[model samples]
Target: MLAPFTPGATAFGLAHVLAGALVLVSLMMLYQDRLPALVNVLALHAALLGIAVGWQAWLQRAPELYITAAIAIGFKAVAIPLALHRIIERLDIHREVETVGGISLTMLAGIGLVALSLLVMLRTAAQADALAREDLALALSVILIGMLMMVTRRNAVSQIAGFMMLENGLILAAAGAEGMPLVVEISVAFSILIAFIVIGVFLFRIRERFDTVDSAALDAFRGELQ
Candidate 1:
């Protein structure tokens, strides 16, 4: 008979801390109006994700997850943030991000989303392992917060950061699930890379044509074209 998987207190505690940090970083991203600072926080978010995934790999004895962690750290943490910094410099975008709602209101909404995720996931995944259940709840919170950021921010760069944050949450959920395929993780990582490339192209095009990367400007242009 196969042995049931069980983790030590230390392992579970560390995983919880890392996952909580990721969600906290998402909340921090919500209040940041400066693009450069937001990108820095995004990098920190990815780094925490990588560390969390690595911890999961150690706990699950899943060697494949280490690769996923590596990809998260290398691409999302280092490469993506550096590329974004260069883009900001090249585009000369220095204005504070224009948001659709007040920071305090958005933060309250984020808190509500976290509470909703925890309540729903805990009830839904009652039969699952405790660590995995908690991870899923926090992951959902991060995903919801990312969506909130995307809808509330007007800057294209901030929207892109939000999208990436959502993807990180997906990866966290996958990492927590048993027997998640390495191939699936790799595919998702590559898809994100391709999307980043396409979005970067669009950002330059938008800036060149309209001289602004605020999404509201795109909306106005579309209105004029109509």
Candidate 2:
């Protein structure tokens, strides 16, 4: 009975499992307390997202999406994390993440967010492909968890990590869609590159001016100068 399914079907099943792993890693990001550790987890998330996208390309027989996956892995998974790690080391900023609540509480909220996403997406996409619906659900969880990190943490670097994680989710969602335009995918990939350069420069400037990357402190400094 199991032999009836084609190789593509097996591959698709594996891809779904891998994409689901990305959501799990994103949840783990909410658990990390150290800056370096958080960055490491984010790198893993991005890499997993890249692989999932590549799997989608294979499933759909879309060569263009392979390029998209390469872009995702090259930048988000590798370059961004390396640059951010260097910034943290060179700037000598606080290495511990300052969170609004305990890690356990954050984890609970993330779980709730995942459940909410599942309920919403399943109901909303009843007519859609099961894999696509699953993709959206996991993607939404990643995006929400990223938002949670940004809102709860004080460190600007951590916030940037959150933002990248959010983008990772968006990429996953786009990749899972079969007929997403090639130009749109390329444009999205280009935007990630541009964002990385802009954010990198901004972080260096911020570190120079304030000698710290705390969002709360940066706001205070702006107010004082104003």
Candidate 3:
């Protein structure tokens, strides 16, 4: 038998479900090649994170956490994706995502990461708060998978998607933590803004110079210069 459904227990169950969804999306991102699909997946992950935050807010009876959930839904789930879509349209970089390594290998690594996360969390952090430990383990797995995506993908757009996955994991972890104020939420939003600015600038420069957003081609250019 499982734990009884107390108020916090119910919320914890919802958050656990959200974490599972986040991991699934993270795995999907590893295999997605089309720019539009990548964006959609990122949006889904963000929306799940928002749901987790909202559940936490309701269960914990913290009205302030609701504001964090609102920002997560509004800015990450909607605004960022819309802006990225526009950028893709204007920049004409909605081409196929190129990967340095094969898709099958990337997916296998992602699976390994997920398994490792669950095993490690179950074994080492047994004494920590259950939700906190789960969040930490899930966050690390997502982040590692994102890093693998970034390294194996040779398209700027896909790399950006991978980076967003990492951010989503961090948001999940934050949502699962207790007593985190709205300021932390604002800071996360601000960090995402800064990342977008940097990525946009970098993409523009890459596009302007090479007439392509293929990271492989860009790397070749750097090689010739050296």
Candidate 4:
């Protein structure tokens, strides 16, 4: 789809909006209450991530980022979510998210993380361009939120999903950086995809042994219940 306008401030503003949308998607992923719902939203999140990165690529005329965007769209948006859905179906784990943190507290913590990202990026990337700074800050915020999801969620599948979000954040940051090598970017993307597939296989084994993919249940089997 064509951007509403093509010139200076409008393009910049739209790019900012796209990056901000990515951060919002990350925040939304934090509050997803069910496994299937979370996976579905992840597809959307990946699509948005691709769009945001593709926008950056267009603005900066970076052809390598376009490849990155294609990988995200093809693997992340389509392949991974479909694979995760099958995992959920096969494991019969379409249940509510098991979270320790209360909703209000979790949202507050996410906001604080975003604020922290802003402050940290501003201080550390003082010499970078403002647009890059904004993207990096939002990217960091997404990464932190993903980490929070992994810590708070009880299900191994949820943790995998969180890990994917974290990788998404890293991809966004790498896309924004000017000198990042194309080979390095492809390697990182495929590495993440491989890790995701490995986690899915592990989840299959987790289902057979533990009869559940919930980490608490697994821990209980080992007499390490927490």
Which candidate has the top score in lDDT? Answer: 1
Residue 226 CA displacement from its true place in model 2, Å: 10
Q: For model 2, how does the per-residue alpha-carbon lDDT over 57-77 read when each residue is reduced to its tens digit?
A: 888888888877877788777
Candidate 3, superposed: residue stretches over 4 Å from native: 1-8, 181-186, 189-199, 202-226
**Stretch of 10 with least lDDT, candidate 2:** 203-212
**lDDT (0 to 1) per candidate:** 0.83, 0.79, 0.74, 0.79
Instruction: State the local distance difference test value for candidate 4.
Output: 0.79
At residue 50, what lDDT does model 1 achieve?
91
Per-residue CA lDDT of candidate 1, range 1-226, in tens? 9666655877898999999999999999999988899999999999999999999999998988888888889878998888778777767776655656788999999999999999999999999999989999999999999999888876667877888889889889989887777735563666477466636645654332243467788778778644
- Measured over all alpha carbons after superposition, the RMSD of each candidate to the real structure, in angstroms, is 5.1, 3.7, 3.9, 4.9
* Local lDDT at 146 for model 1: 93
Off by over 4 Å in 4: 1-6, 183-203, 207-226
Stretch of 10 with least lDDT, candidate 3: 203-212
lDDT of 1 at 115: 97
- Alpha carbon lDDT at 90, candidate 1: 69
lDDT by residue (tens digit), candidate 3, 1-226: 9866687677677778888888988998887777787888888887887787788777667777777678678877797788677767766788865565688988998999899988887688788788888877887788888888877875656666677777767766666667666546564675567466646755664433242467778778778645
Write down the RMSD of candidate 1 (Cα, Å).
5.1
Clashes of each: 0, 0, 0, 0
Clashing pairs in 2: none
Supply the TM-score for candidate 2: 0.85
